[model samples]
Target: MLYWALVFFVVALIAGVMGFGGIASASAGVAQILFFLFLILFVVAVVMRLARGGAR
Candidate 1:
């Protein structure tokens, strides 16, 4: 999931550099959504682990 976000971010950068406004914007949006989703999932997993008394 994070890898995909990074891929889209890189794609956005390249598209922006090439003056592809539409493609850049779309890719950036996708990257942002993916990044946030990944963050939320990570937090949820951590919380779940702690609730389970992690490492004990």
Candidate 2:
């Protein structure tokens, strides 16, 4: 999911460079959303692991 976020970010950059305003905006939005989702998922996983006594 994080990788997908990076991919979208790069795609947004490229679209912006190529002057596709709408595509760039949409891709950037997707990247931002994915990035946040990835962070939330990672935090949740860590919390669950700690709850299970798996964290040192």
Candidate 3:
């Protein structure tokens, strides 16, 4: 998931450099959403692990 966010961020950067405003904006939006989602999931996993006494 983090990888995908990076991918989209690269895409957005390239598109912006190429002056493709619409595509750049869309890709940037996707990247932002993916990054936040990844963060949320990571936090949840950590919380769950700690709750389970850090078994893993």
* Candidate 3 lDDT over residue span 1-56, tens digit each: 99999999999999999999999999999999999999999999999999989965
lDDT agreement of model 3 with the native: 0.99
Q: CA lDDT of each candidate?
A: 0.98, 0.98, 0.99
Output the TM-score of candidate 3. 0.96
- Count of backbone clashes, every candidate in sequence: 0, 0, 0
Instruction: Give residue 20's lDDT in candidate 1 (0 to 100).
Output: 100
Summarize candidate 2's per-residue lDDT along 1-56 as a digit string, tens digits: 99999999999999999999999999999999999999999999999999999977
Q: Candidate 2, which segments miss by more than 4 Å at Cα?
A: none
Query: Local error of candidate 3 at 5, Å?
Result: 0.3
TM-score of 2: 0.95
TM-score of each: 0.96, 0.95, 0.96
Per-prediction CA RMSD (Å):
0.9, 0.6, 1.3
Model 3 segments more than 4 A misplaced = none
Query: Ten residues in a row with the worst lDDT in model 3?
Result: 47-56
